[model samples]
Target: MRYLLPGRAAWAVSLTRTIVALVTLFSVATQLAALSVQPSTATFSLDTTTLTIPQVDYESAIYYRDGDPYPHLDFERVDRRRTVRKDHTAVVMENRYVKLTLLPEMGRVYSFVYKPTGHETLWQNDLVTVGGAANDTGWWLWIGGVEYTLPGDEHGTTWAMPWSWEIIENSSRRKAVRMRVREPGTGLEESIEIAIVSGRAFFEARICITNPTDGMVEYAHWVNPQWTPGGQNELTDRTEFIIPTDRILIDERWQENLGPSPQAWQGNPLRFIRGWSRMGDVMADGLTGGFYSAYSHDADEGIVRVFDPDKTPGVDVWTYGYHPTQIPMGSGGPNAGYVEMWGGTSRTYPDERWPLAPDASLQWTEWMYPYQRTQGLTFANEDAAINFQVTPEARRVVIGLCPSGEWRGAVELWRESVHDAADGRAPLRRWEVTADPATPFIKVVILEGLMASEFNDLRLRVGSDQDGWTIVEAEN
Candidate 1:
């Protein structure tokens, strides 16, 4: 899979007198032809590799606090004395568009690379350090990547422990690895099946939490990913968070730096990581859509995480700040600043918890993928991401589409709103194109002599005639 757009001749189409020129920039014509004749079956590969990791060594001791608060949990204290090298096992799964790497020792995703661009979407540490203390554990590992934090607050207790893994699927269409760990405090089981399927751009993680106790239990489950979508495991000032929520709650500790809670995010300066001077967490009060993302304007690349808003309504953001001493200690460098996007089962962490009955399990699915060449993202679903922006002053309309799989269809732009087929309205302009995970469709339409106010009514529809069209509203 290639990220750079293939070199192709550009042609212009004149649809009407007001439509000055329509240029098709990126189209996967050759790929479409090859896919047409290929079999419908999906193909993927799964394997294991050993990695020599550089980490800090610590002398640790575990003790139980009797008659103290939270007596059921054990605490650990560590003396970070020296650095050492260790070998860890890594499970890899790959498809046409993406490659996923998981570490059973850490029980988290170590790396997620967009094969097209050869870019790692997750923030990975160069050196691991376990020192910080949290609510549930006395020592927290600062190793990067996505970790499933559960059954306790903060970084949780099982993140630094070794997990049991097995290859659950080896079919032609799909390949997956399941990682399971039981929390020592609660004896609750956490199982995650990370899989890749043929012809799809995104990888899916099916997470299941089981309660084995004889009575009811309350816990908090969060999927936490340290993101640096710009690649090379670094963050920049141009990185913009694409959260589809009107209001958010800022943690009290960061209120002075991030602003008041239950406030609008449209004009918030901290929406970009550069605006923060200190570490903090920001959480969405509610979600207007099913996806949230982060895009780097300088790199022209972005990553999206899609989940059911009803099932996982909690979305939070955490950062180490632009300048932090922990970055050097944790990653062995000062340039590894990254943002954390967390998806949770409840609205708030620690404050809110979900109850589970004995022998019952809760499960949900999430998809993560990369997209490029879009100025920004307005809306996204499992199928595609739509970027539609109109400049009324310049009479320019820019449209971009990044699909998860092969797509052959017509992209139509209408001057007036078309509610139904019986409206008998014609589109102002239409173009037929083919796209895929590696290929994105971008077009710039210059509508000459059109009033500036008319641009507000423009709407876009994309799909094949056989599959029906999906209407996407314009964002100015």
Candidate 2:
């Protein structure tokens, strides 16, 4: 069965949802106004002025997949009923820098838009589709944006069902919303709290998974953030999905994207193999860096996802090969290529699944930053000191550094020529700068004598004079 919600019907449904949400908000406000607050001895304040969460119905097309594990039927005529009910609500959380729209009914992010560039960071599907009777996985629903997978990887049972959400806290400094669901199959409780500040360019996602059972239960906690590097209109082949990992573990069933092959790879199975070829695909072997970035050099806009290594030990990058034409079950349009930077508890795919005993819970925080010209990120800390730069040339290049708090250290810059790329990269030319702890670490370098043609790579390392140089790790 398949159904498509056209623009007119979608607008009607959205209007209805908005009216209902406004009435509900008015009623709640009236009730809260009747309460009397006693002035306390301590200073306490809460602000909900800038925070407004309204509901709207999103229109999309949905259908079932039967031919392969994950298939997209392109046939036009719909055997199923054309008239489908708009049963889901899109909760929009907007701030100064970005706006996050979520569907509570499905516990999925409908869209994440960066307001500065008016670009969406998540790859979104315009039509809402569901699996048919033959596909009994319960996860028949598929749309773009970030979707949470709990109790197990892939789409768990909870994703197809509705989740409960509420604005837990509202303040002038920040606004926070919490969405949660309980897995019926495993009695696991998964919740995600998203918070955004007033003028910040980044947002935070705190994911918590709990095993309520008395016996030991093995589960994987992964923050699967998907984005089409070049957005929906641009070609994905021009985008680069950068994961700082030396080795990549691949699924054996993943069919190699042979250039002349008549068909593309289908389905996303949970199996892992020792090695795989990079080939024409744009993906790294495995991710070694605590952060992953996908950027379109041509467009000069991209996003960066940073995770705390102490909490999230495993990170990897998964990207569907660059296809100029429309692929089955892909994002909305032609240039829409899929790239998912996964931060999980296990190192490689299925290599290790976290074991949680009764009443045990695992939680972690993920930070996402959207930028206009951030070519790539070398390293990042929890609070600040996110170091990245654009295309590096020998003579001079502009480096973007975000250093805050007590960052009293020296940032060292190095360059490696293409000729020295075989062995290990050694520091050819060194330039160091020391800055105050309270200043922002944004610096532009002028490699006066160095020629742009001679260098193939640029490196940034941080340390004090006493400590030499060290990798940039998250420091509280």
Candidate 3:
């Protein structure tokens, strides 16, 4: 069955749907205008609450080594105790589209909820246990979320420590919280400001790292997000990683289990978490785009991260692999498994460290959001995300978009060979709508009985009338 909407002949059939969509758009636009007028009144809110969680405590023996400046914990002699209830402070920021929760003590975003779908995009561990070997500190605390690491490699030095935070911005358009921590091990100060704004679906995280020492220091910074976009707090066979890269360097530990280093990303089994039989870590060698995502086909939901490739060039994927038994000890329950998407200043941990001059600082901005009904993602940028698929076998074309802000735009499809002639011709198809991040726009067009080669050379573009700009364009 072939279906088309807003076409010359099909307009009458889709009139009712068009009216309903316009009404919804009008309502949203009215609300946004009201919010803009009342600058003092905030549409978003930021507050703190106490959370009682179950955690297993451990007793550790501390020891110092000769010629070593920092003390280390003896994980070999530590004793594990029974689980107990503990109270922690949770900072929450909410808007109409999403709700974000952060734990200052953990120095990470504990939860990110997309209000429209009622799905938690970040993986949260049920139990907090302390175990596992780290690069600098031998032991690591196994509480999961979006953890920020800096001044050191492999989990950093402040993930488990307390951080000071304050409300930095509160207005009708935006609300944010800044969490700061001074690393005692490296004498560096790190702060991350997480913000949620009105009329936007994504949350922004701005990170700043300052070196106060008299001598130059080498350090590594990474934002590690453990994602379970399916909302089940687990990984499934259908979960796929979308990294726009040509090659990947598999970590040495997984070389035998997976394959050799520097393998092509396309046609590689590493794209899916289920392809691996054991735990592994892989780093993208060259990033062709500024964004990456982890999408689940079963749930039709995914997490997208947008950042500047010039500033934060590093991207890595780590998975606990498949099955309950493969889940690392002290991290989560039997059903707990997640894919960790890491973005940082350096490509690989410990192997490549960036140098920070004395009294110098580095800063960058990144946005994270949850998207749905896209089937998959092909391209993404600061303004919008696009999925353009041409299924010649099915004789169909699908266009999906998730915009960051309110947009009044037209999606146009053009046959390049015909459109590029001396006399410019009109598009083959055009659909107009008012869309925002909360309301994603998707359209499927049937080619009918046309041959596949007829549409092979095509261009898809999203043009915004309000801003007089082209949001995104893709050619297939």
How well does candidate 2 score on lDDT at residue 286? 41
- lDDT string, candidate 3, 1-476, tens digits: 00111111211224444344334334423432332233232347777777655544443455667765344665544433334556778777777677778887667887787766777787654545555445455556656679888665677767755689888888777888899988777788899999998767788999999999998888888888889987776776689899889899987777987789989887688888778777778899979889999988888778889999988898988776766353432322255488889988897754688899999999999999888777778787766777887877777888888777776788887765433424767877888967776678888888776688876766776775456544333324
**Candidate 1, lDDT over the whole model:** 0.72
In angstroms, what RMSD does candidate 3 have relative to the true structure?
13.1
Ranking of candidates on lDDT, top first: 1, 3, 2
Worst 10 residues of 2 by lDDT: 266-275
Question: Mind giving the per-residue lDDT tens digits that candidate 1 earns over 1-476?
Answer: 00111111111111331121111101111221222233223436677877555554543444447643231222223323334556668777777777777886668887777766767788755555544345565556566778997775776667855689998998888888889988867778999988888878787899899999998888888888888987857786688888888888987877886778878877677778777787778888888888888888878788899999888888888877765544533323346478888888888754678898999998889898888877778778777777888999999999988888787898899876666646776788888979886788889999996899999899898886698888877777
Clashes of 3: 0
Report model 3's TM-score to 2 decimal places: 0.84
TM-score per candidate: 0.84, 0.64, 0.84
Clashing pairs for model 3 are none
Model 2 scores a C-alpha lDDT of: 0.51
Give the whole-model CA lDDT for all candidates, comma-separated: 0.72, 0.51, 0.72
Better of 1 and 2 by lDDT: 1
**Which prediction has more favorable TM-score, 1 or 2?**
1
